[model samples]
Target: MATSFIVVLLFIALVGYTRLAEAVSENPTASQIRFLLDEDAALRQKLHTRIQGLRQSVSTLNASIVPCSCPLPTTPAPRTQVSYTGTLKSTMSSLNAASVFNFTGDLINVGAPYTPHDAHFVAPVSGIYGFSLAAYMSPRYYVYIDLLKENAPILHVKTGHYYSGSTNRQVNLGTNFVLTNMTKGDHVWAKYSGGSAYLFGEGVSTFSGFLLYEL
Candidate 1:
């Protein structure tokens, strides 16, 4: 009886040992779980650091490209303009003497630079200018004129008598354009050169000038 009881005790101990081995093989150890948690925390930290570095780089690039505090440019206003036109009121005749033609009538005058009493245009500002003149005379009479800038002739118009077999013949002479650069306070006018010429005082004689552009 003693021998049989000892054998049964040995068999029970062997079965308990086999069940403990199977449990250990199927489930993870405490140390292994702790190691996996530590690895996951390290990966998250690395990803967060990379994201912060990228954000800093983008902020630096934006600061370099954008302006901080500069004012915008503004456009300038248009320049001022001056112009004048006048005509003769009566006949002017001279022999062996040169005289400035007096345009006693004003067709249009802007900026008040031209006066009928002076018979000239004074530039108010430095710029490019255009001038024109027209003159007429009776039959058998000649016409000679010059456009003068500060006492110097820039253009001239002269017409000789046309023999049309009639003493009552008339002639017209003119300069359509005289473009020149002028400074401020420059004086411009038309003068009749000395000769046996009659500048018809009638409205047929005209003088005009205008500022083309500012310098």
Candidate 2:
């Protein structure tokens, strides 16, 4: 801004000097020359005072500005991912009531929540979870399986038996899923509820669960 003001002042001074030179060349009068010089000096003094005022205004504006005092935006921490998958490796026949089916083969345990040693998935954090239980039975035999949470039944599934007089005794698969909320240290597992038959394993039965979201 100051540079532009100086350029405009120089242009005005040049025009005034050119007009004064033309007047002196035409009239050749000392009084007229002195009057033009005085007018030019007054105009220059007025412009210089205006420029000083503009500089003082710019300095005051710069001093009055304040930097932002508010805090910067923050990033949230990442969420914990919890999930597990296990399968029964051996078949169990003639199972007693409330028998817990241990899935010793652990395929995926992301947060180490599921313990295949005790067939229990202990929750590591409070959240909503989705559990799935699948069971396969031998031909001509069926069993009722229950998905339990801390020894209480939450979901039940049963395999179908082979029909009578059928040449082939076809095996049936039983599967069920339950969505439940669990707190930290809560237990979840599968149990054989009641049936004449038992659970068929050898990778045919599975138990899996995953945390949908945290509370």
lDDT of 2 by residue, 89-111 (tens): 89888798656677768589999
Cα-based lDDT for every prediction: 0.73, 0.84
Q: Candidate 1 residues 96-182, lDDT tens each?
A: 344667775757888877866667789999999999888777656777788899999987876546554665444555555799999
Query: How many clashes does each candidate structure show, in the order listed?
Result: 3, 0
TM-scores, all models, native as reference: 0.61, 0.73
**Predicted model with the maximum TM-score:** 2
Position 206, candidate 2: lDDT: 93
Over 4 Å off, model 1: 1-70, 95-98, 160-170
Pairs with steric clashes in candidate 2? none
